[model samples]
Target: MDQTLTELRTVNVIRYVTPLREGGSMPAIVEADDGFLYVIKFRGAGQGTNALIADLVGGELARALGLKVPELVFIHLDEGFGRSEADEEIQDLLKFSVGLNLGLHYLSGAITFDSTVTQLDPLLASKILWLDCLLTNIDRTCRNTNMLIWNKELWLIDPGASLYFHHNWSNWKEHILTPFALVKNHVLLKQASKLNEADVFCKQLLTTERIESIVALIPTDWLKDEPLFESKEAQRNAYTTFLLTRMQHSDIFIKEANDAREKLI
Candidate 1:
């Protein structure tokens, strides 16, 4: 457990159990020295470290906002841990990711949240929907909620699609006031009856200082090779700046959410 990173723990991978190839990343279930199973996010994943960074920051923000999220850890990959893997893909991924990677503690027996089969408290739904809007996350649609149900509670997962500004920082200004109209397609949109309230609460929590701290959580190794920024520090500044600006204009998104809610409800 690194003291600098606060509550986020660090664990070493003990064994690679299996590959979860549902997504391009091909994250795997690996047993950690901590005696827990974690869905490992490989650095070699197609999206590269961008996806891992997004997952780390977005999931942490969710937890900070009192949303249910799985425990995230920094898992150190041993040099020879995946050498004996039967799958060439997994072996290659493991070889490339023989360093630090992201891991979500596996929630055994957790079921995927299906709106048709379950209903969430309106406030919870609004809070989640608001966070997605704030992060500009485009992956939480009905077709792909990226959510799970464990212990009879909704838990967020797979936040890799967030912080879109990093992908196209060229005209990030044009994107700041960008209306997240796609939020209407969000899985929780139907149940987010309190979007306005959620917006206020989240805006208060996501202050500039908080945004800066969250961006600092990104690993330095992941901040390299950027086409837009000159250095990792610059990249970190860009993230916090983008998020701080977005937080200022949250009303734009809140209105978009409420407008969408009006049509749905």
Candidate 2:
């Protein structure tokens, strides 16, 4: 287990309130010490442990893969909105099954829609796509636009839909491929000298050993006796295996990205 994950377990001062927003999953704004705010998310009712595990593992793995993901921590609360009248209004507003505060990225200036793929740096987009492929992330589509740009650096959010591939891994061939379009033809790709370096980044960052090490940090109690993964060891092994298999196939992705860059000529 990573020591950081070990240290995360010690954060016992979680406060709950009605979420500022809710969407695919419930989300609330939480005020932490040092004026840092985090968006806390809870596992929906009967969704089982998959949602929690996906957030933890997928977030950590993206960090491991040299992508920017929000810092995540596990929190405990004695009571949910079911116990408070103020929280009840939040429940009525969002109707989240579990009580938790989701972190908010307090951005300065104004939030406006970035309308074109060319508006973003292509190399950064390629890196995000590579990390998504490594994790089998399928939610970062054109419609959702999950990537956020702050100070010209790309940060990934809402990875709750990754990892399991939403049970659609077998049909990857039918998926509309978009990363190559941006990488191949976008002008930003021309400016990004480091775009070609992502293959090396992928190799160094997504190693099987590293993936297993992070997976070990998943709290066992949360997954107690879950049938999908018999034990933590099994879960770690499975994730490691998936990474290894994906790495073997990454050459095609890398080659396509390179070929796309070449076509920009």
Candidate 3:
């Protein structure tokens, strides 16, 4: 792990190849100036930039914890991006997303992770389960693992649905200590037998400085229009605080996950 905060490289989208509609956000594969394809998550999607913020924070946090995640980049969509597109819907999508977006490096020849066919060590599974609990990620379910096996390693993807508390920030602080009931639905919950080990290991890695660095990665454009906050900086501070608090009281969710697992097995 680098242990240093490096800004994501910004790449201009040169071509919109095709849309991956498997996700509700409708992220697409597009060719960038660097000649690599990225799955670009549009800001015009239903959840807006909140989804982008979650992707950046959650994905980077996973990387910080020594997990495999595809490289994340800032995809710049010019105003003239989809003018020639015959599909009116796609053109509108391009028009609305004519600014900064989030992209993940396309994993060629990757296969969806199936838990039934492959078994992971209890420690790794516990770590992953702990991560999802800390982020309040509700998308890593049996139906949609949101994980891929590329190069014979498990790679996490599409954390846009994590940090869902931000979607309704009315009482965000209250969520900090709440038990994540959704962990029972997590696909790896059954295999997460070492929550205590994962808790200690993950906390050591996710220091206050690291948490601040991860929250700082959120693009200013994503937070600028947040109506609840007076400025983007304040919004960023809130995210940093939320994550730091969660790390401090990790046992709350860890026990919840353990209980859920006990019920399962």
Instruction: Report the lDDT of model 1 for residue 101.
Output: 94
Q: Better model by TM-score, 1 or 2?
A: 1
Candidate 2 or 3, higher TM-score?
Answer: 3
Clashing pairs in 1: none
Candidates' C-alpha lDDT: 0.86, 0.54, 0.91
Model 1, stretches more than 4 Å misplaced?
1-7
Q: Summarize candidate 2's per-residue lDDT along 31-83 as a digit string, tens digits.
A: 55535556666554234346666667777777776677767766543344345
- Model 1 clashing-pair count: 0
In candidate 3, what are the lDDT values of residues 93-145, reduced to their tens digit? 88899999999999989999999998999999999999999999999999999
Estimate, for each residue in 206-230, the C-alpha lDDT of model 1 and write its tens digit. Answer: 6666667778888899876667777
TM-score of 1: 0.94
Tell me the TM-score of each prediction against the true structure. 0.94, 0.68, 0.98
Off by over 4 Å in 2: 1-10, 17-22, 33-35, 45-48, 80-82, 86-118, 165-196, 224-230, 252-265
The total of clashing pairs for model 3 equals 0
Against the correct fold, how does model 2 do in TM-score? 0.68
